[model samples]
Target: MRLGPDTLGTLPAEIAQCGYDRAGQAIGVVHFGIGAFHRAHQAWYLDRAMAAGERDWAISALTLRSPTVAEQLGPQDGLYSLTERAGAGERTRVIGAVREVLFARPDAERAIERVAAPECRIVSFTVTEKGYCRAESGGLDLERAQESFYPVLSAALAQRAARGQAGVTLLSCDNLAGNGAVLHGLVREWLAAHSPDTLAWFEANCTSPSTMVDRIVPRTTEADLQALEERLGLEDRGAVFTERFSQWVIEDDFAARRPRWEELGVQMVADVAPYEAAKLRMLNGAHSLLAYCGLRAGHTYVHEAAGDPALRQLAERLMVDEAMPTLDPAPGQDLAAYARDLLTRFADPALRHRLDQIAMDGTQKIPQRWLDTAAWHCARGQAPGAIREAFDAWCWHLADARFVDDPEAKRLVRAASGGGRQTLLDACFGGGAGAPLWPEYAHLRPLFEGRRGGS
Candidate 1:
């Protein structure tokens, strides 16, 4: 039978089912994105918190554009299975934290109403890096902002202010550097332009805390669905497959009462900057290196790439030598141990994380993941070798026929084709004058020329 409320009691004894009563659970969070990563990471944490007796923290998940997730979870009553894979071991659990799923397009009014509700204390987002409609200047692109969640959220906040209700926390769970501050800036910019009257109330009432979320949630395959069916005796279409390890470091600045997430292995801290920097520079930076260099080396999956001695060495060097030095880690946080743990996580044999998946939106990711680290070294009169190699690999990947997923694909392709090395560098780094590593780029010209000639 298909997994739903009714099938919960009939699942196999070994499969962990939700122990909490869903009927008594109240919707307190209105999440913007109901994607797989959110399901495996944030939703999983909230599920654990609920299972531990926090009943009012259930989620009303919103899908802004795609209706697939809403459809998948709606039929199941927001009931789905989470499979944590580590080597030969795996565990499946039904998560009931997502109480409702709404498609934001048709259900925009309903979603706004839900957010405006007094019970909704947190409005979280997992809308990816590009979803924020951020411009190159690190501010909200007013033109693009119109199509984002800003309008919907602004309307909701305006409603709440009009009713004199308490404000909600805005939590951004994307992988961008300073995600919370970026989100707040975007919201404020949007509000200032469109609804100037509401800006004061929002600034006074709301809190947007930065967060660093880490988990390797790959795209689920049909084999995974089949395994779930055979093992648990239920077919769950909205299932997610992720690695066993997960980490969430949140800034402790919520506007309203929140789930006791710290009790469930989440790190609640005063400043999430150090944690965020480490994650962006080390974990995500290494992933980008692996994705570009690994694909060029003919590896499809992250594990295969990580298992390669040369690629592994490059990854470790990038993390330990280049990225780690750029971070000011929190007290008691061991950078070396964290680097070692990351290598192990990347080598997980059970996670078939596609390099192409990580390769998508390279233009949006590379600045924080690599360029900033390289620039940091450049400022200190040190050239990071691994980053240079990774940057060259990225250029090659952009030129390849297989790469066409980035939002800036056409521009990058033009740069790769027309101006050769320097032009491409200028295009990516915003010209020689403004480029952070202009001098370094000049020094690397010979290397770029040789690689281009070989290709």
Candidate 2:
């Protein structure tokens, strides 16, 4: 039997099922990019909130690309299993927060209607870094904006405005610097280009609060599915695997009334910038470094690479020496301890996070993860040695003919083939030899060349 409303009573006693009454709940959040991360993190938090008696914040999830998620969850009545792994221990729970899943393309009209509903107070996103369709110059690429969620959002907002309805909060849960502000800016730009009349309404009505979400959710495999079946005595296509640790630091600036998420362990703060920067620079930066360097070192999984003495040292230095110095942590924030925790999380063998998964879309990720840190040190006349090495590793990864899955792969590969190290730096960082950090990068030519010769 498949895991659904009908099979809810058949689950094993040890496995926790959704304790809340799903029929009484209403959809208040329309989430974009319904991937594993969203299911395991934000949706999980809302699930807990529901379990604790908050009934009106169920999620209506939409997939921007593939229908895999929608197909997986739709048949299961928007129910799924979340497996949290910690060392040798594991816990399983059925999450009932996602009330429905819609494929944005085929169900475009219904998706818009859902977002335009007055009860929908929040429209969140967990699209990856590249999903924003950002340009190298840091603004919305109008040409690429057509293919992004901006158009759908604009139409929904327009519909709501036409109906004289209230505006919804636009929460960005992506791993980008100032994600909320960035998303708002892009939406404004997109509105200005396509729907000029909606621009003023968006500016006055909607709120995009920055958020910092943390969780290590690996891509689920056949083994995970098999294990879940054995544990639940049913098949759950929407099952997701993640680490035991999960956190959400949301900026307290919603336009309308929201769920009592604070009571559910969410940090509703005035500003998420400090937390955001620490996660992006320290945690994400180290992940990128590990991904590129670890893959080059023939390590497939994050734990394998994090356990390697040489790779671990490089990751540690990247977080503590390079990334940590650039952050302005919030009051009571312990960055050193945070870095230590991140290193330990990266070393969690049970998570089985793959290096290649982290390596995807390097062009979209490196600027926030590494280049910004390098620029910070360059402004201070100090070279960030760890970042430099990681940058070189990224270049090496780009140059490899093993099929990079980056948006700018062709451009990166072309740059990697010509003009030596400067050319590659120019392609990746966008400033060629004239960029402020060019000198620091150029100085690493000897190191890169030596690595080429197996030093």
Candidate 3:
């Protein structure tokens, strides 16, 4: 039987201790982009907060682009099983923080209404890097505003302002650097285009708290569902599989009411920039490198890539030599330990984090992950060798017909096909040509070019 309120009582006794019985929690948060990561990370944290006696923080999850998640989870009354895997062991938790789910296409007004509600004091979301509709210069990409969440949020905030609703906190759980500020800037630009008064109201009211979220949530597959079903003795199409590790470091700034999330394992820090930089550069940067290099070396998943000696070495070199040097770690934080932990997590054979999945939207991800770190190294007369290799792998991946999905695929592949690696690097630097990739790695440029052509 499908898991729902009706079936809650019938869930195995083993699952009883998992999530608290959220029988009458109010929907205090309206989150956009209902995906596996959101469910696994944010909702999971909220579930713990509720379990610890917070009542008014249940989430009204909304999907902006598709109804697929809502369709799968709605039937179960927004309840789903999170199966955390580590090697041969599995731990299942029935997350209940999602009190309601909505599809934004046909229910945009409803979504706006929900966010405008008095109880909805927090509007949080996890729409990935590309979802921000960011421009090349790191501000809001004004041209892509219509297709972004910014416009939708602007409309919702306008309604709230019109209704004289109190300000709500807008928390961003995406991996972007200064994600909260980024979202805030985007919303401001969006409102500027549509309603300047609403922009004024928002500036006086809402707060976008930056957050650093860490977790490995691979896209759920049928095998995961089958494994869940066998374990629970019930068909749970809404089940999501994730690694046993998770971390959420949020800036301690909110406009209105919020859960006492700090008591529930969430690090409420004053300055999240240090944490954000370290994770972005070391963890996400290495992940992208692994994605490109691993795929080129015939590996399918993160563990497979991490287990490969050559790829593993490359990842370590990138993390310690290239990425870590760029980061100014928090006081007393062990950078080496952090890098080792990431490699250990990456090598977890239970999680099947696909390279193609991480490699998506390379054009959007490159600026923050690679280019920033590369620029840092270049300014010091140091060669970003590991990053160059990863960039080469990305170019090679784009050139391959099998690998398709990057927004800049056509241009990148064209460059890689004819002009080799230099053309691709030149494009990344916006026609700066060989300057960024110069001096330190100038002698090594031909190596990458020769490898790409020879292959």
- Scored by TM-score, the top model is 1
**Each candidate: RMSD to true structure?**
2.6, 2.9, 3.2
Residue 15, candidate 1: Cα error in Å is 0.9
Best-performing candidate as measured by lDDT: 1
Higher-scoring candidate on TM-score, 2 or 3: 2
Q: TM-score of model 3 relative to the true fold? A: 0.93
lDDT of 1 by residue, 350-401 (tens): 9999999999998788878987887788778888888888887888887673
Prediction 1 TM-score vs. true: 0.95
Task: Give candidate 3 misplaced runs (Cα > 4 Å).
Answer: 16-23, 432-455
Ordered from best to worst lDDT, the candidate numbers read 1, 2, 3
Residue-wise lDDT of candidate 3 within 209-268, one digit each (tens)? 899999999989998888777777777777888998888899988998788888878888
Enumerate clash totals for all models, in the order shown. Answer: 0, 0, 0
Taking all chains together, the TM-score of candidate 2 against the true structure is: 0.94
What TM-score goes with each of the models?
0.95, 0.94, 0.93
1-455: candidate 2 lDDT, tens digit per residue: 99999989999888987798897988999999999999999999888888988868999999998999988999999999999999999999999999999987888888888899888999999889888987756788888777768877889999987888888999999999999999999998898888888888888889999999999999999999998898899999999999989889999999898889899888999999999988988999999999988988888999999999999999999999988888888999999999899999999999999889999988778767877787778778787778877877787787773637887777667666655555665543345544332333444343333334011
State which candidate, 1 or 3, has the greater TM-score.
1
